[model samples]
Every structure is written in C-alpha cells, then in structure tokens.
Target chain A: MSGVRLLVGTRKGAFVLTSDGKRQDWMVEGPLFGGWEVFHVKASPADPKRIFASLSKGWFGQVIQRSDDGGKNWEPIGNEFAYGAGPGNHLWYDGSERPFEFTRIWQFHPSREDPDVVLAGAEDAAIFRSEDGGRNWDELTSLRASTGSGWQPGAGGLCLHTILSNPADPAQLRIAISAAGVFGSEDSGKNWKPMNRGLSSEYIPDPDAEIGHCVHRIANHPERPEVLFMQKHWDVMRSDDGGANWREISGNLPSDFGFAIGVHAHEPETVYVVPITSDSEHFPPEGRLRVYRSRTGGNEWEPLTSGLPQENCYVNVLRGAMSLDDLDPCGVYFGTTAGQVYASADDGDSWTEIVRDLPAVLSVEVQTLS
Target chain B: MIRVRLPEQLRTLAGVGKEVGVEVAGEITLRGVIDAIEASYPMLRGTIRDPATGRRRPFIRFFVAEQDYSNLGPDDPLPTALSGGREVLMVVGAIAGG
Candidate 1:
C-alpha cells in the first residue's frame, strides 16, 4: 500500500503521523521523549523503516535517537557533538569574537543511497557527518575554515539550519546558516565556497558582503538541483545557477519576511512559502494564514487559502516546518508555532489540519512510502 | 556497592528507578562513583556533566547527606556515608526552568 508518514519535531517531543494515499484519515502516535525539545525528525530515503530524530533539552544537552523499525522503537545513539579543528571563534551579535560551541542538531539529512550515512547541521554553525548511522559524527571542518570569523549570529543563535544534497550528484552539496549566507561544496563537503554572490542585505553595513546574510530557508526540486529558491530574512530570492547568483523574487507576497519554503515534488518550477508579517512580528499577515504558491517559478505568486484560517490566525511557520511528499497530487505539509500541522493533499489548492496542540512544532518532514 | 540517585529526567533516560546501585572498583570518590554510573548506563554520559570539560553541567547539582558537593573537586572523596552505602549520592537538576 502506498502511504505517507509525517515526522514532526515539536518543542516538547516528536510525533509520527501516518495515513494512506487517501490522506483523509490519520493515526497520530506521539510525545516521544516527552518533556524534551525535538528539533528535527527525518527518515532515510533509501530505507523507509530507518528514522532519525534530534532530541535535546536545557538540562540534558543533546541526544540523537534512531529507529530502524520505523517510529515504533528507538535507541539513543551518540550525542557527543564536538567542533572539529580547534572549535574556533566567530563574530557574536555585538561584533565580538565568540568561541564556537556545539549546542544541538538543528536538522538531519540522511544519505539518499545509504541509510547508515547521515549529515547533521548543528547550532553555533557547523556540519557533522555520521557514516555509521547516528552512533558517531565528525565535523566537516572545511566549512568553518572558509571565513567563519566573519560570520555572525542572527536572532536564532548562529545555527546551520539547512542541508541540501544534490540528487544528481551526491558529491555536490549546499548548506545555509542563519547569518553566514550559503556555501557550496563540490568534493563531498571537504571544501566549501560562499555562494552568496547576488544576495544583498540592508541589515549589514556592507549590503553585499561575501559571507553575512540571514537566509531563512532554501528549497529545490530533485530533478532541477541547479535551480534554488530561497526565503531570505526580508526577501524571497531565486537562483538558477546552482547558487552562484541570486535575484529577488518577492513579486507579490503580502509580506516577504517569513520562513518555511518548499518546492513541489513533481513540478520543477512550482514552489510554496508561508509569508509572516515580518521578522519582528512572526505571525500571518492580517491574521490570515495562507500558503503562497508560485506556478511559474518566482516573481509571481498566488495565495492558497481554500482550507486555511482566514481570521485571527496568528501563527508563525518556521524555516524547517514545511515539506513535500512525492505523491501523484503532491502533498504539502507544514507545522506552525501555534502547534498545528496543516496538510494539503492536492498540491496547495486545499488544506486540512491533521493534528493540533502538539506543542510548538519545530520541523515537519514527510516520507512517501510504497 | 554504592547507591546513587539521579534526577527524574536522567532516571528516565537511564531506564532505571529512583536509586541505582553500582560496584565502584577503586576509592569511592565522587569521580569514581560518576564513572561507575556512566559505565553502567552509557546513555547518561554527557547529561550530568560535560564530556569534554569534565565539569558538572551548570544546572546539575551533586549532593551527599544533604551537603552540596557540586563545587568539590571531581577526585575528592565523598562523605563516608556514601562509601558505607548508608546515603545515596543525589544528582539533582536545579530548579531553574519556569
């Protein structure tokens, strides 16, 4: 049977939601690791049964949980995330040098070919790869070596929040840090180069600096890995040349300052984003929740509000809270700060609240199973 | 055998009850008891203290016979009550969160 599994990471715990292709009914099993904050939960593409979750708390630090039999059972793996190559310094918010520290894993990117191989993007801005599943991790030090001192923390505390792997070529990768801009690697994360050529940020003194831009999120279709869509701190941007250059695409959004951007599973040019009011005001514009869709790539978007809230809805969609499933109609799902998981079975035409009041959702990911 | 107590969260993580008993091989010092606890339950390694710095986590406190030993050196000998198994070493998570 073809079904979909939604791995939702929440402020308190992680939930696994499953439903058949109809996407009408759901089975919610949840609160795994209750009282702990689950940053991200994702499954390996090669094996649907294999799943990984990033669990952390203020008192316990970080713990990586893995499940080989889907989400029914889990075991704690290595939580030791030490910075590689001396754990150097980066610019703090006040323009002072601060030593890089490993806080928690913000997101996990499992290998498309091997379930045992995975990559973790951690706070304090660094990337760690674990080849032996989640038991061991090694930081890809070259990422920090490429002008890390110039990097500074956004309001989100200098975290490497996104990791995008090229489906066409696994060796080619791209990662985005909160205030460090984007970087690309050709030789499998061993070396990296800043890919923020055309990005301009008014917040910085130099509008077009090489390595400082608060990029909220980045998305791309698997077939079209060279083209990228980004939701920046204040603008919606697009790149057509593997992130070598980018241009503003915030054509007609009510507000271009928001998080959570995703691409359609089948349509290479179709994209989705939830625009909040602004960076300071993290809520839907005008108290109406809408997922903006762009059918012709960028610069043109339409609000999808069939089954969404239209009045007094003040929830914020985080950067990692949106995902897409590879079904025929292309299922789009997203979580919000108000603890709601909304799913659109037929692209972004209509939506449904699968579950609500499950703590503040940090991340939402879906796996299309056969 | 030395009895040790962990916080509710650590006890849940270690899959144990309120108190756990472990046989310390060497001198029943604070460090040896912690080492024995970690050896018996590998999942609780980095929770109570940092692995790199070997210092107690800011929110984690250590007590024996109702005396704060968090500031004591790791190698310092705990109270004789712990060595005789009369008092369990209490590992507490400070009351900080609202």
Candidate 2:
C-alpha cells in the first residue's frame, strides 16, 4: 500500500513508522542502532529507498549508516570527518577566542538529483560532501574558513544544524549555524557568503554585527523557497528576498522564543511555530501546548490547540522535531522531548498522539511514498 | 589464525560471531590483528580505532588471558597464548553511559 514513512531519530536510536494514506494506524519498526544516539535519519527525495542516518555516542564517537532498502537493514559508511586547520577562532563564553575543532554531524542532506551525492553539516560549523554515496567525504572548507571565523556557539555547540536547498535553483544552498546567522552559496558550496543582513541579536555586544546571530531554525515551502521564515533565539523573522534581508515578524502571538518553524505544504503563506516561554524556560507558554499558525506569512497568528494539551504540559519541541508531509490535505507531525509523536492529518486543525512511549525524539522527517 | 572477540555492539554491526578468527601470517601484535580484522571486515574500520590516527578508541580496551594490553604500544608483541592462537583476544566496550 502506498503510505508515509516517518524516519525518526532519537536520543537512543532510530525508528521507522509506517502508515497508509488514512494516517490513523501506524506500524512501528525499530531502535535500529539500539543504544546509540541517532542524531538524524532522512530519506533522499530523489530516491526514497536510499536512507541515511547519523548515529553517535560520546564514548564510541560517530558512525554514518546508509540503508539501500528503506529501513530494513543498514551498513556503516564513512564517519571519518577530518577538519582542515587554519587561522580561525570562535568566541568563547568569556569572550575569548579558541581554535575550531570538528565535533559531530548535526544534519545529513542527500542530493535531490543523485542518490550518491550527500552533504554533512558538522559541529564547529563546517560542511562536508560525499560524491560516491557515503563512502568518502571531503571538507567543503570554504564555508567556514572564509566568512565564518567569528562564529560563536549557542548553548549547543556551534553546529551547522540546518541545510536548505532551493527548489527553483538546484545549484544554490543555504545553511544555518548557531550563533553565526545564515550563509548561502550560489555555486554548490564551493564558496559561501553571509546572508544575515537585517537580522539582529541582543545577546551579542554588537546587535548589528554581520554574524553571531543565534538562528534556531529556518523553513520554507518547497513551491516558493524565496519566501523564508526563521525562528531566531529572540525573534521570529521572514525574508522575502531569498534571505538577502530579513525583518522581525513576531507580531501578535505569544513569546517569540522558539526552535521549530515550518511552512504548510500547499499554502506558501501559512507557517507554524510552537512558542516556548523563554530560553531559560523551555516549556510552552502558560504550560499550554499550542502551535501558532501565521496564514499571512507573519505578524498575524492563531493558536491551534484543539487536540493538544491545554494544561500542565511542559514539553519543549526541538528544532528538527517538526516536519510536513506533502499529502492531499497535508499531514503535520512533531515529536516531543517526553517521548510522544503527534500527527495532524487535517492541516493543523487538530492532532492525535500517534505513539506513547519511546526514547526522547531528536529529529523527524516524512517521506511520502507513492 | 588469531581469534579475536568483539564487543556486543561491534559484533552486531560487523555481522560477526561472538568471536571471529583472522589470519595473521607474521609475528602477531595488536597492530597486525587490527589490520587483519579491518581487512577482513572493512566495515569495522574506524569503530574500535580512529581511521586517521589508528589510536584505539578510549573506551575500547584489549585483553588476552586477563592482561589488559590497552596501554601497550600498538606494535607491542601479543601475549604468548594469544599469538599461539591458544587464548582469544577480547575487545571490550567499557561499562560507560548510564
């Protein structure tokens, strides 16, 4: 049966949930890398059978696993992420500078055209690409060494957590690094330029600096990649000019502090964000779990809380936890830190808890199978 | 043939038995056994040791007949029993992570 596959990464391992078009009943299959931390698991849009996963353990390091037949079996591929040493320094907590070091892979984006081509966004803010599937990797060194020297780590390590590929222009890509703002490359990651103009961060000494803005997450509808929306550490922003400039759009909703922001599948103007109380308070506003939708792109908003918890709920949705499936009515899915997966089949009108217990959900991606 | 035992996780990942044997023709040492194991099962590379530096991962220890050879040099001679194929060399994953 043609269905949807939710590739879920968790603090412990990876899980694959399958459901038919109805989106009601789901068959769960996994804890694949059993006790390891599966950072991210995603299927390539070009070929749904090709799935890539990043699994890491602080003691055992990291491993990149690829599955040729969906999630049935996996093989460990290249996890050797070597960094090039150069004259670059990052801002320490005390405002001092430190040399850059390679950490873990935060996001793995496979090519939309070729299944063998993939991109790995790493901690310490760098990009690596593999042309022959995941067998070999070479550092896309220009992204960091050139314009990202002054990058600083947000509470999490300074990591390239988001990679957005423009659907209109195949050669263009945009990556978001914590505390470093946004950067884009026109020629397929050979070179990169800061695309963080008009964005401001109050935490940094210079609110108007070119870099050091803590961008939590950025989202865009596949139909129109130019109209982008971002959830920064302090403000919700929108960019109409392919990210060249951004303006605050944290209009009438509740708190602007959030991590996950996503656009609807069909409606380019509609977006969804779950507002947390603040950085220190990571829970939802008034302990009420609500997903605020901006149908006009930004400024005006309405909370979708019919099937969500209205009281005594204190789960924080992460940056990579929310995703939208391109179905007829559009299925929106989000996982919580408290080990719950919620699915809304009716375009944010209501939701249902799909799964009750699992490890804390880390990242979620949907593959609409034909 | 030098008999080597992998940890539970590594065993499942490498699709091997609890203990697998690798052919080492010359004087057997930690380095020789590791090279033979990685050559035999290429997927096991970079898991127990760093692919670049070849240093044993801090959490993985080596022992043969109750002797911990983890601190010894890579090319250090294997224990008499281990080299003679009488005792199995065990790759241990430390009891870390709560």
Candidate 3:
C-alpha cells in the first residue's frame, strides 16, 4: 500500500491520481462527474477505497457524490440541497438574505471515529451531519445558533468553509467559517464555542474582535491531537489547547491573506502555505507564485520556488487544493485557479507541474492504495 | 429570441468586446444558443460545450432572468417575458468555494 493516490476536485470535474510507489510514473483517472464544479473531495481514512466529493450545480443546488471502488463508479448521495427558499423568503435563520446566492458544499470531512459520520460545511454558513455515510443528513442546530443576531455577510458570506476533526480525539472538532471566525466542539459538534480570541481580521479594524473573522483553512497535527494550524484572512495561527486559545505563528511569512494550508502527515511542526495578494486583484503578488514552508512550527519561514513558473504568472491557489501524502518522503500537491496542478516530492524544496489545461482545481487529496 | 450576457472570461475567449447576440426560433436551449454563438464565433466552438456530448462546460451556467436553468431542457421555449425582451438571458461563470 505504498503507492500514492491523488484525488483532485476541480471547477469542471474531479480527477484521481495513482502512483507506482516510486513516485515516478503516475496514473490520472478522470474528469469524473463532468459539468459540475467539485468544491471538496476526501478519501475515507477507514476505507481508502471509498471517496466522497462535494459538487456545485450553478444555481440548481449542491450534491455529494461517493465512490466505493476508487474512482471507477460514482453515485449521488441524498437529495440535492438548495440554499434558500423560493425568492422573497430567502432569509436564512439569522435574517440575512443571500446575495449572489448559490448552494455549495465548501468543505467535507469524514469522522475520525465513525466511518458513517460525515460532516459538511456549506454555503449560507450552515453545517450538516450524516450518520449513514452521507445517505442522509441533518442540519446541526448548534452551528446555526452560533450566527448571532444582525449577522451581515462578508465577502464570501458567513461561509462554513473548513471542518477539522482530531484524529486522536473524536469527541473534539473544529470548524472555520469565512466571516464567522472559528468554532470548536469538544462534544463532537453537539455544542460549539467561539475560538477566535487570538486571530486578527484586517477587514474589521478592531484587532480585539472575537467573531466575524475570515479563516481560509484549518489543519490538525497528525501526532499532536491538541495542536492545530489555521490560515486566516489576516494571520496564520496555531493552537495547542485544542483550539481553546490561539497564537500567531506567522512571524516571518510574506503575507497572511492567502488560502490553502497543509501539515506534514508525520511531523507535527512542519506545514506549508501559498501566499498571494489578499485584496483588489487576488493574484500572485506582482504576478509571482510562491509556496512558503515553515518547518519550525511557523517560527521561521522559507520560500520554495525552484521549479514554478517565474514570468507572466498570475495563478492563485485555493484553500483545499493543497495536501500531503503519507509516503515515506511525503509528496505535496496543489492546483491553481489557472487550471494547472503541481507536485513536489522533496517536501517544498522544488516542484513540477503534473497536469495542465484542466479546469480550475478547487481541492486535492491523496489516498494510499495497494 | 434569447439575449444572453456573456461573462467577462467568455467574452474574452469569444474575442468579443461586448455581449454576443443570437436568436432562436421555437425553443431556447443551451444547445441552441451555444450553436448560435459558435456559429457567430467559431473559435468558441468547443469552449462552452464539450465536443463529445454537447453539454455545457462545468464553469459556464445559464440563467433565465434570475432563475437558474439547471434542469431545464436546452430546447425549452423561452418564457413569454424572456422572448418579448422583458428579461435577459445570462451565461455566467460562477465563483464558489475558496
């Protein structure tokens, strides 16, 4: 089971990567479920053969697709969920009418303890839980209640974009929303509390604000169950007390307003993030793409730009598009909004474009299969 | 007739500075407008619709007024309001996720 499997969620479709343990030759499987935008994709840790994908259908609705035999066959699970009611009665529970309203499942996480328990973070800043492997789902009230009164939508709205569960402790979970900041549940999402004390939001002038901060990605340390890393709108933060409190670890990074974060599968301190322009035009700063690596737990940062394009580059990497493999040396992969995929075998020291001219990739995952 | 507003990217790809206009006789369908647009600008032949299945590409979407045209038949007749120029057809590229 040394071979590495890659699952790519793209704007147009989804792709699977299979490698020959050596990491030299790779097999790419599909543009599966074409004509649908795949926002997030995950391979079940309990059953590597099973894969799940969250897809967006323009204005129709959002759906989840599952693959039991790798990427060979796909099935839509449950009914497609729409964001709002008809037209006028479109106010969410917190009395916010959705502008540019569209139903999209932004993040998906399979329960660390229960294989059937899948958590979904969707548009309108809502969280849904499935107990029967996504065959059915129920909206969790705890998350809906967290949106306080008079909640105004942010740039992406109060979007529930990231959901993370501790591998060592199933009872603990954390979810990051775009404008609502981060919330954690020590009782497996049954109850949640705000965890945005140390996080900073440039959108909000007040540095002491507790909620309404935008978070791009949240990743848990593979070994340390209590340690977690977050790439936020204005800063990168790390929490040692299971998200109870956070501290800024982005001491020497170029900028903090970019998406995408990855933690080493075996090393608790190693992580990666790609930094880009935050406002105005969100392209690579001055049209240059750079992936920053922090090996000393965000204490120090180094730029990894060996094999990436140097000239006329303006691609932006999304949040869930970057990931790491569990292989011995650990392989890193990320996709760009410019429709290209890059891979680095030697940590973040260098890179290579594995696939190009595909649809804009939204998310990427690596599953190991024998 | 279905008046579709081309998104910025599609407008760039089609080499048109502004919206491209096309006409359909009986029914307004993605296939119909796509054919009309490709006929007007052949360079956009395989850009929006897949050459194999003639289905709209993943990033592109069709909207009638404010409603999404997801499950509607491509050849479904344009509503009276849309046909009478009371509404505008939209071919939009949606931005989602992070």
Candidate 4:
C-alpha cells in the first residue's frame, strides 16, 4: 500500500506522522529527543529508509541523529562541526568584524542517487558534505573563497538554510544564506559564485549589491529546474535562467514578506507563499492566515482560503516549516509557530489539521512512498 | 574508583543513573576524571568539553564538594577526598536557560 510520512522538527523534539496514501488518517509518534531542539528531519530520496535529523540545544550544542529503518529507530552520529578554512571574519550586527563560528546544523540535503552522500548546511554560514552516511563531515571550504569577508548575519544569524540540488544535472547546486543572497555551484559544491544579480534590498547601504539580500526561502520544480521562486525579505522573486537574473513577482498579494515558498509537483508553474504582515510583524495580515497561489509562474496571484482561518488568527510560518508531497493531486503541508500542522490533500483548495499542540515546529518534510 | 554526578541532560545522553563510577589512574585531577569518563562513554566526548581546545565549554562547570573547580586548571590536583572516592565530582550545566 502506498503511504506518506511527515517528519516534523520542533523546538522541543521530533515527531513522525504516517498515513496510508488516502492522506486522512494519520498515526503520530513523537517527542523523540525529548528536551532538545530538532532543527530538521529529512529522508534520503535514494533510500527512503535512511533518514537524517539535525538535533541541538542551547546547553548541549548539536547532535546528528540517523535512522536506518525509517523513523522507527535512530542512532546519534558525529556532532563535531568545525569550520574548514580557519575562522574568517564577517560583519556583525553592529558593523564590527566577528569571527565565524560553527553553532548548529540548520538544513540537510541527501544525495538523490546515494544515501550515504549527504550535505549539511550550518549556522555561521558554511557547507559540509558527509559521504559515509553522516558519520563524518568535511567542510567544502572553497565556497567561502568566493566572498566570505563581506557576508553578514540577518536577524536569524548567518545561516545556510536552503539547499537545492538539480535533478537533471548532478553537478549543478544552489544554496541560500540569509543576508548573503544566493550562490550557485556548477562543480558539485567545489566552487561557488554569487547569483544575486537583479535583487534589490533597501536596508543595506547599496540597494543592488552583489550579495546581502536576506532570502528567506527558495524553491523550484524538479521538471523545470531553471525556473526558481523565492520569498525574499520584502519581495517575491522569480528567476528565469537559474538565478542569473531575478525579477519581483509579488503581484496582487496582500503582503510580500513571507518565509515559506513551494512549487506544485504536478503543475510546475503553480506556486505558493504565505504572506506575513510585514518585516517587523511576522503574523498574517488582518489576523487572517492565507496561502496565496500564482498560476502564471510569477505575477498574478489568488488567495486560497476555502478552509484556512479567516479571522482572529495570528500565526507565523517559518522558512523550513512548509513542504509538499509528490502524490497524485499533490498534498500540501505546513506547520505554524502556534503549534498547528495543517494539510491540504487536494492541492490548496481546502485543509485539515493533521495534529496540533506540537512544540513550535521548525521544519516539516514529507516522503511519498509508492 | 571515583563517583561522578552528571547534569540531567548529560546523564540522559550517557544512559546512566544518578551517578557513575570511574577508575582514575595517577593523581586525581579535573582532567583525569574527564578522560576516564570519555573513555567509558564515547558519546560524551565533546559534550562536557571541547575536543579541539581541551578546555571546558563556557556553559559547563565542574564542582568538587561545595567549592567550584571550574576556574582551576585541568592539570591542577583536585581535592584529596576525590582520590579515595569519598567525595563525588559534579558535572553541572551553568544556570542558563534557553
């Protein structure tokens, strides 16, 4: 029987929700690492049974947990993450130079063909690759050689949050860092170059600089990897030639400052974004939680509000808090800062709460099993 | 044999009880007890202290009896009571909450 598993990473622990493709009834099992914070939990596409989770705490530093039999059991792997090229200096919030330090893993991207090969993005902004099933990791230091001195932290610290791997070209890769803009690697993460050409940020001294854009999220469909959608600090951007050039696509939406963005599996041009009120206030506009969809790839957008909260709701959707499954009709899932995980089994027309009262979800990932 | 008390989180990570017993060879010192603990539980190698600098983490503290041994050097000899296992060495997390 076909099934789906949703791995939820929260402020307190990790939860695993499973259902048989009907997407209605779900079995929730959770609080795995009881008191620790789970930043992300993701399954390997090549081997669905292999899963990786980024677990950490303010008192305990960081811990990486790996599950061989799906999410049934997990074993703690290596937790050591040291910057490769001796700690370099970057602009601090006060405009003073501060040395880069490794704090925690923010995101994990496993190789599509090899389960043992995975990539980890870390805070203080660096990338590490693990070839031996995450037992060890080596930093790809060459990426910093491109432009490391000028990178600064956004409000959330300098974190390498979003990593996108191309399905057609194995060597092509893209990663986004807050306050540093987007960077692309054509040689499988060995070398990188800033890809923030047409992006403009008013907060920085230079509005159209090469870097420092503070991109919250970036997503692209596997079928058409060249086209990308992004939720920037204040603008919804769309790139045509894979980040070489970007243009604003925040048309008709109530607000453009959001953190989560995703593309539909069946329809590549169909995209989704939750419009937060503004940069200072992270809640929805007018206390109404809505998911705006665009069918024309960029400009024209429509609010999908059949089953969403219409009034007296103020919740924030984080960057890694939303995901989509590749099943027929395509299920859309998102968790909120207010501890609610909602799902729309039929594209974004309506929704149902999968499970509530989870500790402030940090990330939600979906695995579609055939 | 020396008795050591770990913080709640470290105890949970190491899968131990209220306290653990360790065999310390040579003079009893802050460094000796930690080496023995890491040798016994490999998973706790980098939790209490950093492996790169060989220094205690800013948030982790070591206490012997009622006095704080956190500021003492790693090689400094600890209280003699610890040598006979009469007193317990406590590994504590600083009073910092998230």
TM-score, B chain alone, candidates in order: 0.93, 0.94, 0.81, 0.95
Residue A355 local lDDT, model 1:
94
Tens digits of per-residue lDDT, candidate 1, A133-175, equal 9898999999998888889998898999999989879999999
Q: Write the per-residue lDDT of candidate 4 for residues A1-370, one digit (tens) a residue.
A: 8889999999989899989888999989988888888989999999999999998777667888899998887877887777778448888988899988777899999999999999999998999999999988989997776787888899898999999989999789999999898999999998899999889888877867998999999999998988999999999999989999999999999999999999999999999999999989999999999998898997899888877888988889999999999998899999999889988888988888899889999999999998
What tens digits encode model 2's per-residue C-alpha lDDT throughout B1-98? 79999998888778888999998877778898999998888878778787756788889899989989998889878886876569999999888748
Task: Show pairs that collide, candidate 2.
Answer: none
User: In model 3, which regions exceed 4 Å deviation?
Assistant: A80-102, A148-150, B1-98
Q: Which candidate is the best by TM-score?
A: 1
Models ranked on lDDT: 1, 4, 2, 3
Question: Residue B41 lDDT in model 3?
Answer: 65
Candidate 3, residue A78: how far the Cα is off, in Å: 0.4
TM-score of each: 0.98, 0.94, 0.75, 0.97
Better of 1 and 2 by lDDT: 1
Q: Can you write out model 4's per-residue Cα lDDT over B1-98, one digit (the tens) per residue? A: 99999999888778899799999988888889999998998767777776656778888888888999998899989998987679999989888758
- Over all chains combined, what TM-score does candidate 2 have? 0.94
Q: Whole-model Cα lDDT per candidate?
A: 0.91, 0.87, 0.74, 0.89
- lDDT for model 2 comes to 0.87
Superposed by TM-score, candidate 1 places the C-alpha of residue B91 at a distance from the truth, in angstroms, of 1.0
Relative to the true structure, candidate 3 reaches a TM of: 0.75
Superposed on the true chain A, the predicted chain A of model 4 yields a TM-score of 0.98
